[model samples]
Target: MNDEKISVDNRDYVGALASGLEVLSAFDVQHKKMTLSEVAQITGMDRAKARRLLLTLHALGYIAKDGREFRLTPKVLRLGYAFNASNDHLDVVQHYLQSVTSELGESCSLSILDNDEIIYLVRSSAAHRLMSINITPGTRLPAAYTSMGRVLLAQLSAAEQKDWLARAQLLEHTDNSIVDKNRFVNMLKDVKQQGFCVVDQELELGLRSIAVPVFDYQGKLLGAANISTNSLRVSMQSLIDKYLPALQDAAKSITAHAK
Candidate 1:
């Protein structure tokens, strides 16, 4: 039933397959492209094993080799696509996200908490760029410093939050980032009480975002919906006064139709 039990009951589980998946996941935002030895180091696998896995993935079209580096290919998108195909609610969420973007002329997104990161499931981008990094579906950001991340984190119970923070190392990405675990916990408590979260240039300079939790008709948590804008173009008061309501309304609309 628990993760430990599942790990122990690995009679049907294929360790090699799991290691191959680990090699795939090791290629993240920071490690976008890596050499064979780098891959082996990250995955803690022998060089020969890593080389075999990388070649198999490359042959399967999931990865592409560029000079000495190997990066995930467009074919890798099929994995994320499979998730979208399985989740009908993502389509409904996307519709409302488009509506939000149309009304506010800003980027809107829906993201779910995945461990210490928030994975964007749906995004409707405005014409202007909001962050130095491109925002898109499947983008992952640190959950400790993102508006949607906090909103999703607020949904967790206190003990769960503590357990997560025990393992999470809050590296300071910016001076505005909450690096102290206790302070971040307090911030989540505030988000829980308010039913929303506003992060102001904490994750990235000049980037501000506000988010509200999304739920199904039966009140099951779906995800968090957020509006991302440039801090220079939008003030904190404006975000709370203008974008927050729109984000909350969109979340409500998505919840209504999600079921």
Candidate 2:
């Protein structure tokens, strides 16, 4: 099992529960509704196991079955809601994110690192969209290719960051994307020292962003906050000189108020 190593040293881990959640996660935006066979293939599980898990989820109201196709139900939203409800600090982050968007006339978002991706929890979008895909709350983007992801990664310990780089599948999203592991690690070190990160059209052709990590009252990492814009409209120097100061102030305010 992919998660077996996670539980290897921890006796409290429940592999079955982990596998069940893995099965549910297989049904994403691209695979909104899938058959048992499709779910099995995506989860790397056998048909019988996948069927069992799906049926269990269906019975529990987390999934719905329409003939041979299965899709998630509204009940599944409780899982994500539970996290948001527990983290009340996110409300503070969202307030500051909206302020950044209002001041800069660009999109700003708050995201947290999840596995190898950064999941947006709060997003204040501008009238103009920067990418083909609509980026809203719940959108997940590759952490290594995003400014917000790099800011969060910069918060990790040296050994943790090194391990992530060694295990990550470096895909080049664009000509500017950093695919070299050593180079990316070095960039993370620079981000750590500078207290911010800038990704210039690395993930999407016209999208450029700058991010800084936000901390809680106890200096614990809360998440990353970023301002995103189209490269043609906003020059890199403008981002550093004009927008960076505003973002940094917002981050400091968010951290101070995060209780």
Candidate 3:
């Protein structure tokens, strides 16, 4: 560790690398295409610094530029590819997800919490239409309003969860979205007690899901898995009663031999 050049050594600040990665991360599902000014505004970085980072990213082929706006290109996928290749466990998790989808005839996903958001690491679809947005390995969703989010959050300690809840600004994506602190806290507790979570029409109308946590052999929380389906196609009660078991089973499968 002494060889590591961290910020406190009267040298380069760790914040610089973090800020550069943040600039890359800011380009996501919604903010895929943005101008230098847009990146500056979104990331709160000065316009000059944002421009430098964007230009560097573009030159490195992680991004593409056309006129005033810039967007991520296929080269950006290399980052994800590298991550997937490095983590051999994701393949095992993906296989479990595929099994769950095959068994339940529903869409299944393996996701990990990332910076207060959930990123789908692997997803298997059962040919049934679900959320309006496409669900794929790279798909990202808000951690606050998703069953997977709640399930992953449930894995956190009570004190850490409270700290997260305090800073979180709950967005009302739909009328049913829970924005109240007490109710949200209570719901997280319920998720912990039940060992699973269900979100009904909170993320999107007709989009219902159930999620269970996946752990590693050493009992470390690895991630969460979920099955998402359309409400019209499957009743909420059935999702909780029927799909929940399948999802939890898949979680166990992923944990049993994830690598």
Give RMSD to native, each candidate.
2.3, 3.0, 2.6
For residues 1-259, could you state the per-residue lDDT of candidate 2 as single tens digits? Answer: 4544554357877877888999888877789999999999999999998989999999999999999999999998899899989989988988988898889899999999997999999999999989888898888899998999999999999988988888898898899988888898889999999999999988889999999998887998888999999999999999999999999999999989999
Q: All candidates' TM-scores?
A: 0.91, 0.95, 0.91
Task: Please give the distance, in angstroms, between residue 65's alpha carbon in candidate 2 and its true position after superposition.
Answer: 1.2
Report the number of clashing residue pairs per model.
0, 0, 0
lDDT values, one for every candidate? 0.90, 0.91, 0.86
Query: Whose TM-score is greatest here?
Result: 2
**lDDT at 114 for candidate 2?**
91
**Candidate 3 at 195: error in angstroms?**
0.4
Worst 10 residues of 2 by lDDT: 1-10
lDDT tens digits by residue: candidate 1, 1-259:
6555346257867887887898899998779999999999999999999999999999999999999999998888888889989899988999999999999899999999999999998999999987777878878898988999999999999998999999998987889988988899999999999999999888888888999999999999998989999888899999999888888888888888987
What is the C-alpha lDDT profile of model 3 across 1-259, one tens digit per residue?
4785465445566766677788888887688789989999999999999988888888888889989999988986788889988988888888888888888888888788875789888888889677777778878898999999999988889898988988888999999999998999999999999898889899898888888889876787888888988888899788877888888777777778965
**How close to the true structure is residue 172 of candidate 1, measured as C-alpha lDDT?**
78
Error of 3 at 247 (Å): 1.6
Candidate 2's C-alpha runs over 4 A off are: 1-9
